[model samples]
Target: VDADTPSACVVEREASTYSGNRGDAPNLRGPKRSKPDASSISQEEPQGGATPVGNRESLGQAGINPVHSPGPAGTGSQPVGQEAKELLLFACGVCSKRYMCNSKLVIHKRSHTGERPFQCNVCERCFMQLSDLRVHQRIHTGEKPYTCDVCHKRFNRRFSLKCHKRSHTGEKPYKCKECKKVFTYRKNLNEHKLIHSGEKPYQCSKCSRAFRRPETLKYHQKTHPETTAPRECEG
Candidate 1:
Protein backbone atom coordinates (compact mmCIF):
# COMPACT_ATOMS: atom_id res chain seq x y z
CA VAL A 1 0.00 0.00 0.00
CA ASP A 2 3.03 2.34 0.42
CA ALA A 3 3.85 4.25 -2.79
CA ASP A 4 7.59 3.57 -2.22
CA THR A 5 7.03 -0.23 -1.86
CA PRO A 6 7.67 -2.33 -4.97
CA SER A 7 4.50 -3.49 -6.80
CA ALA A 8 3.14 -6.84 -5.58
CA CYS A 9 2.10 -9.68 -7.93
CA VAL A 10 -1.45 -10.94 -7.32
CA VAL A 11 -0.75 -14.69 -7.09
CA GLU A 12 -2.01 -17.24 -4.58
CA ARG A 13 0.78 -19.19 -2.81
CA GLU A 14 0.03 -22.53 -1.05
CA ALA A 15 1.05 -23.04 2.60
CA SER A 16 3.82 -25.67 3.03
CA THR A 17 3.12 -28.26 5.83
CA TYR A 18 5.28 -31.15 7.20
CA SER A 19 4.32 -34.43 8.90
CA GLY A 20 5.94 -34.93 12.38
CA ASN A 21 6.42 -38.79 12.23
CA ARG A 22 8.41 -38.85 8.95
CA GLY A 23 12.00 -37.49 8.77
CA ASP A 24 11.00 -35.14 5.88
CA ALA A 25 12.70 -31.71 6.18
CA PRO A 26 10.20 -29.12 7.42
CA ASN A 27 9.54 -26.18 5.16
CA LEU A 28 11.38 -23.12 6.42
CA ARG A 29 8.72 -20.57 5.45
CA GLY A 30 4.98 -21.22 5.31
CA PRO A 31 3.25 -18.85 2.84
CA LYS A 32 2.71 -15.93 5.23
CA ARG A 33 1.05 -12.85 3.68
CA SER A 34 2.13 -9.88 5.75
CA LYS A 35 -0.61 -7.24 5.33
CA PRO A 36 0.79 -3.73 5.24
CA ASP A 37 -0.17 -1.69 8.33
CA ALA A 38 -2.37 1.28 7.41
CA SER A 39 -0.39 3.63 9.75
CA SER A 40 3.00 2.66 8.21
CA ILE A 41 1.61 2.92 4.61
CA SER A 42 0.32 6.46 5.32
CA GLN A 43 3.74 7.53 6.68
CA GLU A 44 5.87 6.20 3.78
CA GLU A 45 6.78 8.55 0.88
CA PRO A 46 8.93 8.29 -2.28
CA GLN A 47 12.63 8.33 -1.34
CA GLY A 48 14.29 10.98 -3.66
CA GLY A 49 11.30 13.40 -3.52
CA ALA A 50 10.48 12.19 -7.01
CA THR A 51 7.09 11.05 -8.36
CA PRO A 52 6.22 7.34 -7.94
CA VAL A 53 6.74 5.17 -11.07
CA GLY A 54 4.19 2.55 -9.92
CA ASN A 55 1.18 4.91 -10.22
CA ARG A 56 2.24 6.37 -13.56
CA GLU A 57 3.16 2.97 -15.03
CA SER A 58 -0.10 1.41 -13.79
CA LEU A 59 -2.11 4.29 -15.35
CA GLY A 60 -0.32 3.79 -18.72
CA GLN A 61 -1.03 0.05 -18.60
CA ALA A 62 -4.72 0.68 -17.84
CA GLY A 63 -5.09 3.03 -20.91
CA ILE A 64 -5.31 6.18 -18.73
CA ASN A 65 -3.37 9.18 -20.05
CA PRO A 66 -1.63 11.86 -18.01
CA VAL A 67 -3.32 15.25 -17.64
CA HIS A 68 -0.25 17.15 -18.82
CA SER A 69 0.39 14.99 -21.93
CA PRO A 70 -0.19 16.72 -25.30
CA GLY A 71 -3.57 15.89 -26.86
CA PRO A 72 -3.83 14.17 -30.22
CA ALA A 73 -3.52 16.36 -33.34
CA GLY A 74 -6.75 18.02 -34.71
CA THR A 75 -8.82 17.06 -31.63
CA GLY A 76 -9.50 20.83 -31.20
CA SER A 77 -10.22 21.54 -27.48
CA GLN A 78 -11.81 18.10 -26.91
CA PRO A 79 -10.18 15.35 -24.85
CA VAL A 80 -8.91 12.70 -27.32
CA GLY A 81 -9.66 9.70 -25.07
CA GLN A 82 -13.24 10.84 -24.39
CA GLU A 83 -13.82 11.87 -28.03
CA ALA A 84 -12.64 8.46 -29.28
CA LYS A 85 -14.90 6.72 -26.77
CA GLU A 86 -17.88 8.91 -27.74
CA LEU A 87 -17.22 8.10 -31.40
CA LEU A 88 -18.07 4.44 -30.66
CA LEU A 89 -21.01 4.86 -28.23
CA PHE A 90 -23.53 6.81 -30.34
CA ALA A 91 -26.19 4.67 -32.15
CA CYS A 92 -29.58 5.22 -33.76
CA GLY A 93 -32.59 4.13 -31.71
CA VAL A 94 -34.91 3.21 -34.59
CA CYS A 95 -32.59 1.45 -37.05
CA SER A 96 -29.75 0.59 -34.69
CA LYS A 97 -27.35 2.41 -37.05
CA ARG A 98 -24.06 3.49 -35.47
CA TYR A 99 -22.55 6.92 -35.88
CA MET A 100 -19.31 8.53 -34.81
CA CYS A 101 -20.99 11.18 -32.62
CA ASN A 102 -24.26 12.21 -30.98
CA SER A 103 -24.68 15.08 -33.44
CA LYS A 104 -24.57 12.63 -36.37
CA LEU A 105 -27.04 10.31 -34.63
CA VAL A 106 -29.36 13.26 -34.01
CA ILE A 107 -29.26 14.17 -37.69
CA HIS A 108 -29.80 10.53 -38.76
CA LYS A 109 -32.84 10.10 -36.51
CA ARG A 110 -34.63 12.79 -38.54
CA SER A 111 -35.07 10.26 -41.34
CA HIS A 112 -37.36 8.18 -39.12
CA THR A 113 -38.97 11.00 -37.09
CA GLY A 114 -39.51 13.28 -40.11
CA GLU A 115 -37.84 16.11 -38.23
CA ARG A 116 -36.64 18.94 -40.46
CA PRO A 117 -34.75 21.40 -38.28
CA PHE A 118 -32.77 23.24 -40.95
CA GLN A 119 -34.97 25.52 -43.09
CA CYS A 120 -34.18 27.78 -46.02
CA ASN A 121 -34.84 31.47 -45.31
CA VAL A 122 -35.60 32.38 -48.89
CA CYS A 123 -37.94 29.45 -49.80
CA GLU A 124 -39.13 28.34 -46.32
CA ARG A 125 -38.37 24.73 -47.34
CA CYS A 126 -37.09 22.47 -44.57
CA PHE A 127 -34.36 19.80 -44.58
CA MET A 128 -33.17 17.16 -42.10
CA GLN A 129 -29.47 18.04 -42.49
CA LEU A 130 -27.66 21.38 -42.85
CA SER A 131 -25.86 20.00 -45.90
CA ASP A 132 -29.23 19.24 -47.55
CA LEU A 133 -30.43 22.77 -46.79
CA ARG A 134 -27.25 24.18 -48.27
CA VAL A 135 -27.76 22.13 -51.43
CA HIS A 136 -31.42 23.20 -51.67
CA GLN A 137 -30.34 26.85 -51.40
CA ARG A 138 -28.33 26.33 -54.62
CA ILE A 139 -31.66 26.04 -56.50
CA HIS A 140 -32.45 29.72 -55.85
CA THR A 141 -28.84 30.83 -56.39
CA GLY A 142 -28.54 28.84 -59.65
CA GLU A 143 -25.27 27.31 -58.47
CA LYS A 144 -24.48 24.09 -60.35
CA PRO A 145 -21.39 22.27 -59.11
CA TYR A 146 -21.64 19.04 -61.15
CA THR A 147 -21.10 18.93 -64.93
CA CYS A 148 -21.46 16.17 -67.50
CA ASP A 149 -18.19 15.48 -69.31
CA VAL A 150 -19.84 14.25 -72.53
CA CYS A 151 -22.57 16.92 -73.03
CA HIS A 152 -20.93 19.70 -70.97
CA LYS A 153 -24.30 20.22 -69.23
CA ARG A 154 -24.25 21.41 -65.62
CA PHE A 155 -26.50 20.19 -62.81
CA ASN A 156 -26.97 21.25 -59.18
CA ARG A 157 -26.91 17.67 -57.86
CA ARG A 158 -24.24 15.01 -58.36
CA PHE A 159 -27.00 12.38 -58.78
CA SER A 160 -28.26 14.22 -61.87
CA LEU A 161 -24.76 14.35 -63.28
CA LYS A 162 -24.32 10.60 -62.71
CA CYS A 163 -27.60 9.87 -64.55
CA HIS A 164 -26.56 12.20 -67.37
CA LYS A 165 -23.23 10.36 -67.73
CA ARG A 166 -25.15 7.19 -68.53
CA SER A 167 -26.35 8.73 -71.81
CA HIS A 168 -22.81 8.67 -73.16
CA THR A 169 -21.90 5.38 -71.49
CA GLY A 170 -25.00 3.53 -72.80
CA GLU A 171 -25.18 1.72 -69.47
CA LYS A 172 -28.56 -0.06 -69.31
CA PRO A 173 -28.26 -1.07 -65.68
CA TYR A 174 -32.00 -1.63 -65.17
CA LYS A 175 -33.36 -4.89 -66.60
CA CYS A 176 -36.90 -6.24 -66.52
CA LYS A 177 -37.12 -9.51 -64.57
CA GLU A 178 -40.12 -10.79 -66.60
CA CYS A 179 -39.24 -9.85 -70.20
CA LYS A 180 -35.52 -9.18 -69.71
CA LYS A 181 -35.82 -5.86 -71.56
CA VAL A 182 -33.06 -3.39 -70.58
CA PHE A 183 -33.50 0.30 -69.87
CA THR A 184 -31.09 3.18 -69.10
CA TYR A 185 -33.31 4.57 -66.32
CA ARG A 186 -35.11 2.89 -63.44
CA LYS A 187 -38.38 4.79 -64.06
CA ASN A 188 -38.52 3.44 -67.64
CA LEU A 189 -37.89 -0.09 -66.38
CA ASN A 190 -40.69 0.31 -63.80
CA GLU A 191 -43.05 1.41 -66.56
CA HIS A 192 -41.98 -1.63 -68.60
CA LYS A 193 -42.94 -3.94 -65.73
CA LEU A 194 -46.61 -2.90 -66.07
CA ILE A 195 -46.60 -4.28 -69.63
CA HIS A 196 -45.88 -7.83 -68.35
CA SER A 197 -48.51 -7.44 -65.61
CA GLY A 198 -51.08 -5.98 -68.10
CA GLU A 199 -51.77 -3.23 -65.59
CA LYS A 200 -53.73 -0.38 -67.24
CA PRO A 201 -53.38 2.36 -64.62
CA TYR A 202 -54.30 5.20 -67.02
CA GLN A 203 -57.97 5.25 -68.11
CA CYS A 204 -59.79 7.43 -70.60
CA SER A 205 -62.10 9.99 -68.98
CA LYS A 206 -64.84 9.84 -71.71
CA CYS A 207 -64.73 6.07 -72.34
CA SER A 208 -63.93 2.76 -70.60
CA ARG A 209 -60.70 2.48 -72.64
CA ALA A 210 -57.58 2.01 -70.51
CA PHE A 211 -53.91 2.01 -71.39
CA ARG A 212 -50.65 1.14 -69.63
CA ARG A 213 -49.00 4.44 -70.59
CA PRO A 214 -50.50 7.93 -70.12
CA GLU A 215 -49.34 9.07 -73.58
CA THR A 216 -51.16 6.17 -75.22
CA LEU A 217 -54.39 7.08 -73.42
CA LYS A 218 -53.98 10.68 -74.54
CA TYR A 219 -53.66 9.52 -78.16
CA HIS A 220 -56.70 7.20 -77.84
CA GLN A 221 -58.83 10.07 -76.61
CA LYS A 222 -58.23 11.78 -79.93
CA THR A 223 -60.16 8.99 -81.80
CA HIS A 224 -63.33 9.47 -79.69
CA PRO A 225 -63.33 13.31 -79.52
CA GLU A 226 -66.85 13.26 -77.92
CA THR A 227 -68.47 13.28 -81.45
CA THR A 228 -68.28 17.05 -81.08
CA ALA A 229 -69.70 17.73 -84.59
CA PRO A 230 -73.05 18.79 -83.03
CA ARG A 231 -73.92 15.09 -82.44
CA GLU A 232 -75.20 14.74 -86.06
CA CYS A 233 -77.89 17.45 -85.39
CA GLU A 234 -79.86 14.88 -83.28
CA GLY A 235 -80.45 12.86 -86.53
Candidate 2:
Protein backbone atom coordinates (compact mmCIF):
# COMPACT_ATOMS: atom_id res chain seq x y z
CA VAL A 1 0.00 0.00 0.00
CA ASP A 2 1.23 3.53 -0.80
CA ALA A 3 2.38 5.37 2.31
CA ASP A 4 0.88 8.64 1.05
CA THR A 5 -2.63 7.19 0.79
CA PRO A 6 -4.92 8.09 3.75
CA SER A 7 -6.91 4.82 3.34
CA ALA A 8 -3.69 2.80 3.79
CA CYS A 9 -3.23 4.00 7.38
CA VAL A 10 -5.21 2.52 10.29
CA VAL A 11 -5.39 3.80 13.91
CA GLU A 12 -5.09 1.22 16.73
CA ARG A 13 -6.32 2.48 20.10
CA GLU A 14 -4.56 0.97 23.13
CA ALA A 15 -6.91 -0.71 25.61
CA SER A 16 -6.34 -1.87 29.21
CA THR A 17 -8.39 -4.18 31.46
CA TYR A 18 -8.78 -3.96 35.25
CA SER A 19 -7.93 -7.05 37.32
CA GLY A 20 -8.63 -5.25 40.61
CA ASN A 21 -4.89 -5.46 41.47
CA ARG A 22 -2.35 -2.66 42.13
CA GLY A 23 -0.08 -3.80 39.25
CA ASP A 24 -3.02 -4.32 36.88
CA ALA A 25 -3.65 -1.76 34.12
CA PRO A 26 -6.52 0.69 34.73
CA ASN A 27 -9.84 -0.42 33.16
CA LEU A 28 -10.45 1.73 30.06
CA ARG A 29 -13.71 -0.02 29.13
CA GLY A 30 -16.51 2.52 29.40
CA PRO A 31 -19.23 4.08 27.27
CA LYS A 32 -17.85 4.30 23.76
CA ARG A 33 -16.69 7.86 23.08
CA SER A 34 -16.88 9.21 19.53
CA LYS A 35 -13.74 9.08 17.39
CA PRO A 36 -11.45 12.06 18.16
CA ASP A 37 -11.45 14.76 15.50
CA ALA A 38 -8.06 14.87 13.74
CA SER A 39 -7.85 18.65 14.08
CA SER A 40 -8.65 18.68 17.79
CA ILE A 41 -5.86 16.36 19.01
CA SER A 42 -3.26 18.18 21.11
CA GLN A 43 0.23 18.11 19.53
CA GLU A 44 1.79 17.57 22.99
CA GLU A 45 0.23 14.11 23.36
CA PRO A 46 2.32 10.99 22.64
CA GLN A 47 2.11 9.74 19.03
CA GLY A 48 2.03 6.03 19.89
CA GLY A 49 -0.82 4.14 18.19
CA ALA A 50 -1.86 7.33 16.34
CA THR A 51 -2.48 7.26 12.55
CA PRO A 52 -2.09 10.35 10.39
CA VAL A 53 -5.24 11.37 8.43
CA GLY A 54 -3.82 13.10 5.37
CA ASN A 55 -1.31 12.26 2.61
CA ARG A 56 2.04 11.45 4.18
CA GLU A 57 4.07 13.32 1.50
CA SER A 58 2.49 16.74 2.05
CA LEU A 59 2.23 16.33 5.86
CA GLY A 60 5.87 15.22 6.18
CA GLN A 61 7.12 18.54 4.77
CA ALA A 62 5.26 20.54 7.46
CA GLY A 63 6.95 18.51 10.29
CA ILE A 64 3.58 17.38 11.68
CA ASN A 65 1.02 14.71 10.83
CA PRO A 66 -2.64 15.23 11.79
CA VAL A 67 -3.36 12.20 13.95
CA HIS A 68 -6.76 10.54 14.32
CA SER A 69 -7.62 7.85 16.86
CA PRO A 70 -10.75 5.74 17.46
CA GLY A 71 -12.49 5.39 20.83
CA PRO A 72 -11.40 2.85 23.45
CA ALA A 73 -11.44 -0.76 22.29
CA GLY A 74 -10.87 -4.28 23.57
CA THR A 75 -7.68 -5.25 25.45
CA GLY A 76 -6.23 -6.87 22.32
CA SER A 77 -4.86 -4.05 20.09
CA GLN A 78 -2.82 -4.14 16.87
CA PRO A 79 0.07 -1.82 16.06
CA VAL A 80 -0.62 1.32 14.04
CA GLY A 81 -0.29 0.73 10.27
CA GLN A 82 2.27 3.53 9.70
CA GLU A 83 4.69 5.22 12.08
CA ALA A 84 3.60 8.77 12.97
CA LYS A 85 6.58 11.04 13.42
CA GLU A 86 5.91 14.70 14.14
CA LEU A 87 7.42 17.76 15.81
CA LEU A 88 4.77 19.33 18.02
CA LEU A 89 4.22 23.06 17.54
CA PHE A 90 2.97 25.52 20.13
CA ALA A 91 0.94 28.40 18.71
CA CYS A 92 0.53 31.93 20.08
CA GLY A 93 -3.03 32.89 21.08
CA VAL A 94 -2.81 36.57 20.05
CA CYS A 95 -0.91 36.49 16.75
CA SER A 96 -1.48 32.83 15.77
CA LYS A 97 2.31 32.45 15.25
CA ARG A 98 3.68 28.97 15.98
CA TYR A 99 6.80 27.81 17.86
CA MET A 100 8.49 24.46 18.52
CA CYS A 101 8.12 24.75 22.29
CA ASN A 102 5.78 26.33 24.87
CA SER A 103 8.61 28.44 26.34
CA LYS A 104 9.36 30.02 22.95
CA LEU A 105 5.65 30.69 22.45
CA VAL A 106 5.54 32.38 25.86
CA ILE A 107 8.53 34.54 24.91
CA HIS A 108 6.98 35.44 21.51
CA LYS A 109 3.68 36.44 23.16
CA ARG A 110 5.55 39.22 25.01
CA SER A 111 5.82 41.17 21.73
CA HIS A 112 2.03 41.39 21.58
CA THR A 113 1.44 41.79 25.34
CA GLY A 114 4.40 44.18 25.84
CA GLU A 115 5.68 42.15 28.80
CA ARG A 116 9.38 42.76 29.59
CA PRO A 117 10.46 40.33 32.27
CA PHE A 118 14.25 40.84 32.12
CA GLN A 119 15.55 44.21 33.39
CA CYS A 120 18.99 45.83 33.52
CA ASN A 121 20.22 46.56 37.07
CA VAL A 122 22.15 49.66 35.99
CA CYS A 123 19.59 51.44 33.76
CA GLU A 124 16.45 49.69 35.06
CA ARG A 125 15.37 49.32 31.41
CA CYS A 126 13.33 46.20 30.70
CA PHE A 127 13.65 43.77 27.76
CA MET A 128 11.50 40.87 26.63
CA GLN A 129 14.42 38.38 26.50
CA LEU A 130 17.29 37.78 28.87
CA SER A 131 19.83 37.95 26.02
CA ASP A 132 18.54 41.39 24.97
CA LEU A 133 18.73 42.63 28.57
CA ARG A 134 22.31 41.37 28.82
CA VAL A 135 23.20 43.20 25.60
CA HIS A 136 21.54 46.39 26.81
CA GLN A 137 23.46 46.23 30.12
CA ARG A 138 26.70 46.38 28.09
CA ILE A 139 25.93 50.08 27.37
CA HIS A 140 26.35 50.83 31.12
CA THR A 141 29.23 48.36 31.58
CA GLY A 142 31.16 49.70 28.55
CA GLU A 143 32.03 46.16 27.52
CA LYS A 144 32.98 45.59 23.87
CA PRO A 145 32.99 41.81 23.62
CA TYR A 146 33.17 41.64 19.82
CA THR A 147 36.44 42.79 18.20
CA CYS A 148 37.46 43.26 14.56
CA ASP A 149 40.63 41.55 13.30
CA VAL A 150 41.28 44.13 10.54
CA CYS A 151 41.19 47.51 12.33
CA HIS A 152 41.09 46.22 15.97
CA LYS A 153 37.80 48.16 16.40
CA ARG A 154 35.46 46.67 18.99
CA PHE A 155 31.67 46.62 19.24
CA ASN A 156 29.26 45.64 21.99
CA ARG A 157 27.17 43.52 19.59
CA ARG A 158 28.35 40.88 17.14
CA PHE A 159 26.13 42.30 14.38
CA SER A 160 27.81 45.75 14.74
CA LEU A 161 31.20 44.08 14.41
CA LYS A 162 30.04 42.21 11.30
CA CYS A 163 28.89 45.48 9.68
CA HIS A 164 32.14 47.19 10.70
CA LYS A 165 34.22 44.48 9.01
CA ARG A 166 32.31 45.08 5.79
CA SER A 167 33.81 48.62 5.68
CA HIS A 168 37.33 47.16 5.48
CA THR A 169 36.32 44.55 2.88
CA GLY A 170 34.66 47.28 0.75
CA GLU A 171 31.52 45.12 0.64
CA LYS A 172 28.39 46.99 -0.45
CA PRO A 173 25.74 44.32 0.07
CA TYR A 174 22.77 46.69 0.26
CA LYS A 175 21.46 47.57 -3.20
CA CYS A 176 18.78 50.00 -4.37
CA LYS A 177 16.21 47.98 -6.30
CA GLU A 178 15.18 51.02 -8.38
CA CYS A 179 18.59 52.46 -9.42
CA LYS A 180 20.70 49.30 -8.95
CA LYS A 181 23.09 51.44 -6.83
CA VAL A 182 24.82 49.59 -3.98
CA PHE A 183 25.45 50.98 -0.47
CA THR A 184 27.74 49.81 2.32
CA TYR A 185 24.99 50.33 4.90
CA ARG A 186 21.23 49.81 4.88
CA LYS A 187 20.67 53.28 6.46
CA ASN A 188 22.44 54.91 3.51
CA LEU A 189 20.28 52.96 1.06
CA ASN A 190 17.15 54.08 2.90
CA GLU A 191 18.30 57.71 2.71
CA HIS A 192 19.04 57.29 -1.02
CA LYS A 193 15.43 56.08 -1.53
CA LEU A 194 14.20 59.50 -0.32
CA ILE A 195 15.82 61.01 -3.44
CA HIS A 196 13.71 58.76 -5.70
CA SER A 197 10.51 59.57 -3.74
CA GLY A 198 11.39 63.29 -3.52
CA GLU A 199 10.58 63.24 0.23
CA LYS A 200 12.42 65.78 2.44
CA PRO A 201 11.25 64.69 5.88
CA TYR A 202 13.75 66.85 7.88
CA GLN A 203 12.46 70.46 7.77
CA CYS A 204 14.35 73.49 9.15
CA SER A 205 12.59 75.07 12.13
CA LYS A 206 14.04 78.45 11.19
CA CYS A 207 12.81 78.32 7.57
CA SER A 208 10.52 76.37 5.17
CA ARG A 209 13.59 74.63 3.63
CA ALA A 210 13.62 70.83 4.03
CA PHE A 211 16.27 68.12 3.49
CA ARG A 212 16.27 64.36 3.05
CA ARG A 213 19.13 63.95 5.56
CA PRO A 214 19.16 65.14 9.17
CA GLU A 215 22.82 66.27 8.83
CA THR A 216 21.83 68.50 5.91
CA LEU A 217 19.15 70.13 8.06
CA LYS A 218 21.71 70.57 10.82
CA TYR A 219 24.06 72.30 8.35
CA HIS A 220 21.20 74.56 7.22
CA GLN A 221 20.37 75.36 10.87
CA LYS A 222 23.96 76.68 11.30
CA THR A 223 22.92 79.67 9.14
CA HIS A 224 20.34 80.59 11.84
CA PRO A 225 22.80 80.55 14.79
CA GLU A 226 21.74 84.15 15.74
CA THR A 227 18.10 83.07 16.10
CA THR A 228 18.99 79.68 17.69
CA ALA A 229 18.64 79.48 21.45
CA PRO A 230 21.69 79.20 23.74
CA ARG A 231 22.67 75.77 25.07
CA GLU A 232 21.65 75.16 28.71
CA CYS A 233 24.31 74.32 31.33
CA GLU A 234 24.56 70.59 32.17
CA GLY A 235 25.47 71.30 35.87
TM-score of each: 0.44, 0.50
Q: Candidates' lDDT values, in order?
A: 0.79, 0.79
| Model 1 TM-score on a 0 to 1 scale | 0.44
As a whole number from 0 to 100, the lDDT of residue 87 in candidate 1 is 65
Report the lDDT tens digits of candidate 1 across residue range 58-154.
Answer: 4676566777677779977755775666667777778888777789888888899999999999989999988899889999999999988778899
Model 1 clash pairs are none
lDDT per residue, candidate 2, 174-222, as tens digits?
9999999999999999999999999999998889999999999998888
The most accurate candidate by TM-score is 2
> Which regions of candidate 2 deviate over 4 angstroms?
1-98, 101-104, 204-209, 226-235
**Error in Å for residue 44 of model 2:** 58
Error in Å for residue 95 of model 1:
3.9
Error at 195, model 2, angstroms: 2.0
